[model samples]
Target: MLIVEDLLLLLLDDETGTPAKAGTLPYALGGAVLVELAMLGRIDVEGAGSVLSGPKVVAVGDGPLPDPLLQEAYDEVTRKPRTVQTLLLAIGGDLWKTVTDRLVERGELRRESKRVLGLFRTTQLPSAGTGHEARLRAAIRGALVDGTEPDTRTAAIIALLSGSGALPELRPQLAWSGEVYRRAKELEKGHWGASAVGTAVARTTAAIAAAGAAASAAVITTVTT
Candidate 1:
């Protein structure tokens, strides 16, 4: 499974069959793609004096990416010099549909559609089996609640969850703790693996923040316009 897939599974509400939040989901999804590409050595990040100040992401090793969604992201980045924020905005637009299609194809998620008030259609994804989601919950509980040492992927998931802008939506289910949130933030900024890999995560996370800001701005403009 892809890192983004794990992220989707975690972002899902088991009983509700809905995402924890709507706004940050796409950027987080895009961030997951960026991190996965970095993990595969298919992308590189360039930074100036500081980490968050003007980080540019470039694709590495010209080749066809296995996943279509990732390939699309890779293709867009290679076409131009994009900062983490710009790339998040660029790549995140269609991530939900792409990721959900993959999940449906793999039989990991069951998709259902319903009309809301007989006006608009809405989709929901319910878990297909217990094992897939159960393991993810176990990892989260172990890391956040039990204080066990988490593997790199698990650590990244925790960090992504914290950064995902859905904390309030997720807090009750996981028994939220301030200490856990702090640890995840530390890990998000810390090195998860090689120097390059860690830098990639930090840069992507900063981008996620920027994406959130952009979303907020868009909402405000829409409301006041």
Candidate 2:
């Protein structure tokens, strides 16, 4: 599964078929694609270690990616270098639908359609009994709860989950603790070992967190007003 797919699975509520933190889903999904492209050597950030100034994302590879989604992201980067925040929206604007369609095609999720008052249509994606998400959760749970160091892909998912502020939602399954929270926070800092990948991932995670915070504040302000 692609990193974005894995991240989406973790964020989505299995029964509700909605994101645990819907406000950050778009940004997190976008960040997932950026992380995947960086890992694949298809993209990089302008600054390798600078976190103070916003990092601008750049496309480095000219070859086509195996997946259409990755190729689309790479092409967007090739158009022009943009700050991590801007690029996230650019890539993630309609990503939820695209990624959901991909998962449905793979049979990892099944789509059910319904009508409200026989006038409006809605769709929900429930698990297809693939058991992939179960294994994924086990691996992540081991990393967060058991202090097991995760591989690069797993680390990326953790970073996205942390940035989205969705880790606490794992709750009983993960048995949230101080150590688990600290481990997740460390990964969110994006020390991914490779210089280019690390910087890009770090910037993307930072952007996601910032965006999520702003969204929360806006919701609060609206409710208060």
Candidate 3:
């Protein structure tokens, strides 16, 4: 499974299917894909910086990825180099549906829709009872709670969750504690293996913060206006 899918599974409630940290979901998802691409050697940050005056992430290699989602993100990056912040939204905007659709197709999640008030419809993505997510949680819990050394992919997942600020939401499920929080913070500081992946995580962290501030400002404006 893709890192983004794993992150989603971790963030989503098993019984309710509702995702945590909904506002930053797109950026988190997009960041996951970028990190994966960097790990695959399909993308990187331009060493000289962009003409637009910031570090620009560029697509490498000419071939397409086998997975449709990765391919789509790669095609976007191939079009032009952009700052990590730009790519996060460019690649992540509207990705909720696409990524969720892929998970549904994989039978990892089940989608249910119901009419609300007889005229409105609502959708839910409850778990499909697959043991994969259970095992995933176990691994992450072991690393965060038990101080077990995580593999590369597991480390990346922890980094993404930490950077996106969704790790705390794991709550009683992961048995949150000072040790787990500290470990997550350490992962957030990088050392996840790849330099490019670390760069993406750092930039994505800033982007998520900025995006959240912007959203909050908009909400405040709406209410005050």
The most accurate candidate by TM-score is: 2
Prediction-by-prediction clash tally: 0, 0, 0
lDDT per residue, candidate 2, 1-225, as tens digits?
Answer: 899998887777776467776765677788788888887877766654233224677788677898999998889888988777677778887899988888889988889998989999988887776889888888888778887777777877887788667888852246888988888887777654443345655555554444443444454467679
For residue 154, model 1's alpha carbon misses the true position, in angstroms, by: 1.6
User: What would the per-residue lDDT of candidate 1 be over residues 146-217, giving only the tens digit for each residue?
Assistant: 877777677666666666656546623777778867666665554344423456555555444444445544
Tens digits of per-residue lDDT, candidate 3, 66-136, equal 78889999999989877766777788888888788888999999999989899999988888978988888
Top-down TM-score ranking: 2, 3, 1
- Candidate 1, position 36, lDDT: 77
- RMSD from true fold, candidate 3: 4.5
Better of 2 and 3 by TM-score: 2
The residue pairs in collision within model 2 are none
Predicted structure with the largest lDDT when compared to the true one: 2
Candidate 1 vs 2: which has more lDDT = 2
Query: If candidate 1 were superposed on the true structure by all CA atoms, what would the RMSD be?
Result: 3.7
Q: Model 1 TM-score? A: 0.80
TM-score of each: 0.80, 0.83, 0.80
